[model samples]
Target: MPSTHNPGSSSPLTSFGRSIWSRREPFHSIEADHESSEQELELQSFQKLVVDLFHDLSAVSADELLSIAWIRKLLDVFVSCLDEFRVLLLKNKAQVSKPPLDHWADEYLDRSLKALDICNATRDGIEKIRTWHKHLEIVMCALESRKRAFSEGQFRRARKALMDLTLEMLDERDSGSVFSHRNWSFGRNNPRKDARRRQHSSGNSSGHSRSHSWSISNSWSAAKQLQSIANNLIAPRGNEIVATNGLAGSVYTMSSVLTFVLSALVAAIPCQDRALSTHFSIPQQYSWEEQKVEVEQELQELASICENFKNGLDPLERQIRQVFRRIMNCRTEGLEILSRANNLE
Candidate 1:
C-alpha cells in the first residue's frame, strides 16, 4: 500500500500524534529503539541514585531507622566480621568450633530481633522478612571473632541493636507507677543475668524442683502462644521470629524459675544447716569418701541429662537447629550474592 505525501500536504495522524502535536507527526518517522534505550538508562540511573541515597542515609539513619539501615550497612560490615571470624575459626577449628554457635545464637536470637524492626519497616510477608533474616544470620557467623568474646566494633554493633530495640519497645508502653513497677534494661549479651546466675553455687541448689511438670509446661505453653502470634508477622519461612521469641520466652521462663529457686533458698538458708545435720549427721555419720562418691554419681546423672537434651530433645532441638541453619545460610549466601551481583552491575 503506497501512499505518497507531498511537501505541503498533511495525512490524518494517530491518537499518539494528536496528543503530542495535535494530529501532526513531529517527524515523518521516529526511531523508537533509541528513545526506549535512553529511557531505560535514565530509569537505571534513578534506581542507582536511590540506592546511593540509602547508603548516605546509613550514617544518619542510626538515630532513626537503625535496624533497617544498619542491616543494609552490614553488607559491608559483616564482610569485615567474616574475615575476623574466619581467622579466629581457623585457630580454633579443630580446637573448638563453638564460635559458630555464638554467631548462630546472635541471628537465631539477636538477629531475629533485628528482623522484627525490618518487618515493621517493610510491612512485608513473613517469608520475605525471614529470607532476609536467615541470610544475615549466616553471614554474621562467618564474621564471628574469638577476640575477647567480640571486637569492640562488634560490641557496639550489638549494643546499637539492643538500644534501638529497647527504645522501640518501651516507647510504646508506660511502666505505670515508679514506686512499684518493672523497668526494662537491655545490655549487650545476657551479661548481668549470666553473672548473677553464676554467683549461685551448685552446692546451694535446692533439691526440690517444681513438684509438678504441668505447671512448668503451662508457662512455656502460654509463652509459645504469644510468641507464635508475634513470629507469624514475618513472611514465608519467617518462622525464625517465632523461634527467637520462643528462645527469649525460655530465657524469661528460666528467670522466673530462678526467682522461685532464689526465694526458696533464701527462705531455707536459716534452716539448711539444721536440716542437713538432722538427716546425715554430718562428719560423724558420713565419711568424706562416701560423700565424694555421692557427689560424683549426682554429677554423672546431671551430665547424662544434659547430653540427652543436646542429642535427643524429641523434636524441639531438630526444629530449632533447622531454622538456625537456614538463617545462617541465608545471611552468608545473600551477602556473597550481593557482592558478586553488585560487581556485575
Candidate 2:
C-alpha cells in the first residue's frame, strides 16, 4: 500500500535517503558512518522544504486560495523551491552534467524560457487591470457625489465608464493579447543601458538577438505556451531513476511545480488565448500529488473570478487595488532574483 503520510512529512529518509544509503559502500569505519549520516541529513532537509511548501499552499481557505494574497504566497513558494533546487544542482554538478540529468536540466531551462514569456504577459495583465481600475474610479466618483442629489449627467458619465470597461474587457477576450503592442518589461528600465546590452548580446552565437528576443509577438499565445510546458512531463521510470542517482524525482518535482504555478497564473489573470483545460498526470507515488485536488479547486475558483471581474465595481475596485500592490511586490522580488543570478554568474 502507498504511504499514508505526506511524502516527506513522516520520515527524513525518503527516496533520496534510500538512494544515498544503497549507493554508499559498507561503512566499516566510524568516520564513514558519520559522513553517510550527514548525506542523509542534507537530503532530508531538501525533502522537508518541499513538503512544507505544499502543506502551506494546501492549508489556505477557499476564500483566500486564488486571491492576490494567495498568488503572492505562491510566487514566494516558487522562488524558495527554485533557490533550493539550484543549490542541489550545484552540489551535484557532476551528476547534473551527465547524460540523463543533463537532458533534464536542458528541458527545465527551456521551460524557464517559456515561463519568462508568461511573466511578461502577467505584467501586461497587471497593467490592464490598472486600466480597468481607472474606469472603476470614474464610476465611484460619478456616483458618490456630495451634492444635494444625483444628476442625470452624473448617471450618464457612470454609464459611459461602465460601458467602456465592459467593452474593453470583452475585446480583450477576442484579441488574445490586449497589451502586446506595449513595450513594457520588468528590467532594463534604462534605455541607454538596455540598448548597449542588446548590442553586446547581438553578436553571440545564440543566434537570437536580445532586443528581438524579449518582446512577445502579436501571435504569442499563453495557452499554447502552457501546453508546450506540459508536453512530456512524466515521472521517471525505475531505470531512469537509477541513472540519475535519484535526482530524477527532484527534477520532476520542480518541473511539475513550475507548470502548475504558471498554469494557475494564466487561469487567474487575463492572458492572450487564456485557457485552463490543460491536463497533468502527476505520479500517485509522490506525496505532493495529494495537494492536486486542492490546486484544481483553486484554479476553478480563479476561472470563475476572471469571468466575473466586471460584475461588481466596489468589490472589483478593492480587488484591483490589492492586485496592483501584489504585482508590484512580485516585481520587486523578480528583480531581486535577477540581481542574485547576476551576482552568482
Candidate 3:
C-alpha cells in the first residue's frame, strides 16, 4: 500500500505542486499592510475626536464659563469621549491585554475609579445647593414682591429664610464638610436596598461593584482626591506609540482629559476642603490647559458674586432657580454616565 516517487521522473503530483506554488503570493506582507492601515485610521480618528472636544469646550464665552449650563456641557463631552475610548479598547482587546498596554489600561481604570468619588462628592454639593434653593423658595414666597405689597410679617419671614440660608452656607464653610454623613449617591433606588446589595455582592470580585453606593468619610478632601488622580500620570513616549500602535497616546489623552475635567469641576462646584491647587503638567501640550486659568478666575468671580447677590434680593430668586435647574440636569446626566462606567468590563 506504499507509493514511491522517482527522483528524475515528473509525476502528476509534481505538476500540481508547481501550480500551487505559482498561485502563492505575499500574504504575510499584505496582511501586515492591512493591519497597519487600520491602526493609522484608529489613531487619527481618536486624535481628531480629542481635538474637537477641547476646541468646543474652549469656545465658551467668559460669562458662560463655570456656569451650570457650561458644566453640564462639559459632562456631556466627557461621556462622549469615554464612550469612544471604550470602543477603542474593545476593538483592540487582543493587544490591550498584552504588555505595556495592559499596564496602561490598569492605570486608566484606577483613575476612573477615583473619579467616581469626585462625581459622588459633586452630587452631594448639588444636593447642598438644592437645600439652599428651598430656603430661596421660602424667601421668594414670603416677599411676593411682584404680586403684592410687603407686610412686616412677610419681611420677617424673608429675613428669617435669608438668615437660615446664610448660616447653613457659613456652617459648611467653617466645618469644611463637602458631603453629608448620611451616605447618598446617584442612580440608587433606596439606600437600604443598596446596602443589602453590597452585602449580597460582597463575595463578587469585581472592583467596580463597590462604586454603586460609594460614600466619602467626613475627613475626605476633594483637593487630596484630585491630587491622587493627577499623581504619577505621565505621557507615553514616542517608542511606546509605535509599539502599541498609538493606543498609548489615546490612553494619555483620555487620562489628561479626565484629569482636566475633574479639576475644573472641583474648582467650580462647592466641595469640602476647597484647596484649589492641583498641578497638571503633562509632557504634551493641550488646548484645555488655558481653561485652568479661566476656572480660577471664575472662582474669584463666584466669591464676589455671592456678596453681590446677598446685597441684592431682587435677582436672588431668579438666579437661584436657574442654578437649581442647571445642577439638577447635570446631576441627572452624571448618574447616567456613571452607570455606564460601572457596567464597563
Candidate 4:
C-alpha cells in the first residue's frame, strides 16, 4: 500500500494484466457466439422434429383405417395437415391449396437427410415420415379436387368416386381392427368346397397360421381385395389376409344351383308316401277319438289345399254357362219381343 503507485504501475504485472483483459474480452465474445450458434442448431433440430412428427400424423390413408376411432383420427389428421400446409405455403409466399413442395421437396430432403447419414434410426424414421407426409399431401390434394369438382358440377365422375369412397369409409368405420391378436386370425381366403372336403376327409393339418406386420401397401392391397370381393368383380382369393368372410364365387354359384334344383324337384314330384293309403289300425280304447281327430285335421288341410287350387276351373265353368244361358235367352225372348211388335203394328 505504501509503494502502490510507483512500483506496480510500470511493472510487468501491469502489462500482464492488460494482456489478460484483452484476451478475456475476445474469449467472452467467443463464448457468447458459441452459445448463439448452439441455440440456432437446437432451433433447427426442433423444427425438423416437428415436421417429422406432423408427417407421421398427416399421412393416413383409407386403407389404414380399420375402425371408427381410426377413421376419426384420420379425418382429424387430414384437417391438421391441411391447416399446417396452408400456413407453411402461405408463409413461403405460395398458394395454400397448391403447394410447391414437389419443386423443392427433393432438394430439401437430399440436403436434410445428408446430415442424418444412412443406416441410422433417425434417417429411417425420417424417411418413413417423409413418405407418409407425401402420401397425405396427395390425399389432401384429391379431397380438394373432389370439392372443386362438386362446385363445378362435375357430378358424374366426382359423385361416383366420392360415393364409393364414402361407402368404403363407412365400412371401415363400422369394422373392428384389422390387426390380428390370435394365431388363427390369419385365416385363409375361401377354400374350394372340394378342397376343403378333401382336407377335412384327409386331415386338418395343411399349414400353420401366418403372422404379418402391417405396412401401408399391405393394408392398401387388403382393402382393394375386400372391395373387389364386395363389388363381386373378382371372387375372394385364397389366403386373403383380411376380411376372411370366405366368400367364394364357386360356393355362391353352387348354392344358387342347389336352390334351383331343389325348387324344381319340389315342383315336379309329389309325395310318394305309401303309408298314406294304408289303413289306420289302432287299439280299440283310443281308436275312435284319435281317428276322428286325425281324419278331421287331414280333411281340413286337404280342403284348404284344394281351395287354393281353383286354377282355371271355376272361372271357365262360369263363363261357359253364362254364354249358353245368354244364347238361349236371346233366342226365346228376342222372338217374343219381335212377335209383340209385329202384332202391335
Candidate 5:
C-alpha cells in the first residue's frame, strides 16, 4: 500500500491520528474522523460553558449594590465552575494537542484565574461589610443599654454610659490617634516605597477621613443632645427624692420638667420609644390635681415638640428599614442561586 502518513512532520497529534487511522476493528477512517470532530465539538462546548459562566459572574459583580450575600453566591458558583473547568482542562489535555483546542483550553484557564481574582475581591468586600455591620450592631446595643438604664431610673449609670460612648466616638473621630503609633509608623517607615504605594495609601486615607468626619459629626450631635437632656434631669436640687405626703405639690415642678425632658430624650433617641413610655411616675397616693394646670400646659408644648421630633425620625427610620429589606432580599436571592447551583453540581 502507498504511504498515507507524513514521516518527517513532528505534529504531536499525528501519531494518535495515524493510530486511529490504522485501526481496523469497525473503526475506519470515517469513524476516526468523526471521533476527532466530536472531540473538537466537545472542546467548543466546554469553552462556551465557561464563557457563559463568566458572563453570569460578571453581571452579579457589576451590580452597584453588591452585598455580602450576593458575593458569597457568586463565589460559590465560581468555585464550582473553576473545579469543573480544571477537570475538563485536564481531560482534554491528554486527548487533544491541536491548535484551536489547545488555545481554547489555555484561554479558559486564564479566564478561570481571572474569575478567582474576582472571587477574592468579593470576599474582601464581604469582610468589610461584615465589619460595618458589627460596628452598627454594637452601637445599637449600646443605645439599648442606655435606654434601659434611663427607664429604670438609673440616672447616674445612664449618664456615665452615654458620656463614655460619646467620648469614645470623639476619640474614634481623631483617626490619626485611634491606631497605635507603631502601626502608623510602619506605613511611613519606608521612605523608599514606590509612588504607586504612596498614592494608593493616600487615596484610601482621604476617603476614610471623610467617612470618619461624617460619622463623628452625627454621633457628636446625638451625644450632645442626650447630655443636655441628662444634665437638665439630674440638675442639683431639681430631681430631689421628696416624701409621698409632700410629693403632690413639691414634686409637681420637677415631675413636669422631667416629663418634658424625657419626652425630648425619647425623640432624640429614635430607638428608645418602647423604653420611654410615659416619662413621669406620679406617686400612687396622688392624682393629677388642678393645681398643676400651668405645668400641664407647658408639658403639652414640650409634648408637641417631641411629636415633631418623632415625625422627623420617621423618614430616617423608613430609609433604614428599606436598606435592611434590600439586604434581606439579596440574602434570599443568594440562597436561591446557591441552591440551584448545588442542584446542578
Candidate 6:
C-alpha cells in the first residue's frame, strides 16, 4: 500500500470523495444558489450599462443630433425592450399557476410574479411617456399653425370686417325691411288714394284748399311731427363714426333710438286716441275704454319687439365673446410654444 500511494499525495479516490461530499447538499438549494448568483451578475451588468449610458449622454453636446428622429429611434428601442419584457412576464405568469404544496416554492413563485408585475408597470410607464411625447408634438404643430393664421393684423382685420357686416345688416333692417311691415302702418293713409285725389284737384282749387287748411292744420302738423320722429329714429347713425368705434357705438346708437321712440310713442298715444274719438261718434266713456285697450295692445306689441331685438343681440354678443376667447386662448398657447422653443434653443 505504501508503494502504491503516499499519504501526502492526492489521488483519483480523493476527487471522488470530494464529489460525493458535494452531493450531500440538497439539489434544490444548489440550484437556487446558482440562480441567485446569475441574477446578481445580470443586475450588476444592467446597472453598469445604465450608468455608462448616462455618463455618455451627459457628455454629448446638446446641439448634436438631438432631433425628433432621434427621440423616435430611442422610442423604437424602448418598444423592443418592452416587447421582450412582456414575453418574460408572460413566462413568469405561466409559471405562477397552482400554488405549490411547499411553502418555499409558493413564496418563490409569489416573488417571481411580483417582479413580473413591476416590469409590466415599467413598460406601461414607458408607453405613456411615448404617447405624451407624440401628443406634445401635435400640440406644438397646432400652435404654430394658429400663430400663423391669427396674427395681430389679421385679428384686427377680422374685427373690422365683423363690424362692417353688422352695420350693413342694421342698415337693411332700418331701411323698412324689418320694422316697416304693413301691420306697423295699420292706421296710416293709403298713398295711392291720396295721390289720386290730389291729381283730380285743379291748381286754383289746390291754392284755395291750402288757404282753408288752417282749420285742420293742427292735426296735419301733429301727424307730420310724428312721421318725422319715426323717420329720424329709424334712420342709420353716422356710418363713418360707427365704423371706427365698432359694436359699442352701434349698440349705443340703437339704445338711444329705442329711448327716443319710446318717448314719442308715449306722447302720441293720447293724441291718437283723441283723433279717433273725434272721427268716430261713440259714447265718451266707451271711447276712453277702447282707446285704453288699443294703447295697452300697442305697448305690449312694442315691448315684444324690444324683447326680440334684445334676444337676437344676446346671441350675437355671445358669439363675439366666444370668438374673442378663442383668440385669447390661441395667443396664450402661442406664447407658451415660444417659451418652450426658447428653452430648447
List the RMSD of every prediction in angstroms. 29.9, 14.4, 21.8, 43.4, 32.0, 43.9
* TM-score on alpha carbons, each prediction: 0.17, 0.62, 0.61, 0.16, 0.27, 0.17
Per-residue accuracy of model 5 over 80-183 as CA lDDT, tens digit each: 43344344433443322333233322332232222221222222222222333344334333334323122323323434444554443444334322122222
Local error of candidate 4 at residue 249 (angstroms)? 48
Better of 2 and 5 by TM-score: 2
Give per-residue CA lDDT, model 2, range 76-190, as digits (tens). 7767777777766667766665678767766776676567667656655655765776776677667554554456676677678867877777677767654556543433243
Q: What is the C-alpha lDDT of each candidate?
A: 0.28, 0.57, 0.57, 0.28, 0.30, 0.29
Model 6, 1-345: lDDT tens digits are: 001232122433233223322321222233444554443333233323333332332232333222222222322332332233223223333222222212222322222222221222222222222333343333333223223233444334434443443453344323422212222111233355336445533222221111111122212323343343334232223442222222112212222322332222222222211121222122212332336456346446545434433333233222222322322333233334334544655
Q: Which regions in candidate 5 have their CA more than 4 angstroms from the true location?
A: 1-65, 94-122, 145-345
| Model 3: residues with Cα > 4 Å off, grouped in runs | 1-36, 147-151, 178-215, 275-345
- Model 4 residue 219 lDDT score: 29
The deviation in Å at residue 128 for candidate 5 is: 2.8
Question: Whose lDDT is greatest here?
Answer: 3
- Candidate 6 lDDT (Cα, 0 to 1): 0.29
Which 10 consecutive residues of model 5 have the lowest summed lDDT? Answer: 207-216
| Per-residue C-alpha lDDT of model 1 across residues 202-319, encoded as one tens digit per residue | 3222212111112212122222322332342222122321333222222222122222222222222111111111121112233424455564465465454334333322232122
Candidate 6 TM-score to native: 0.17
Off by over 4 Å in 6: 1-59, 64-67, 95-345
lDDT of 5 at 269: 29
Name the weakest run of 10 consecutive residues (lDDT summed) in model 3: 19-28
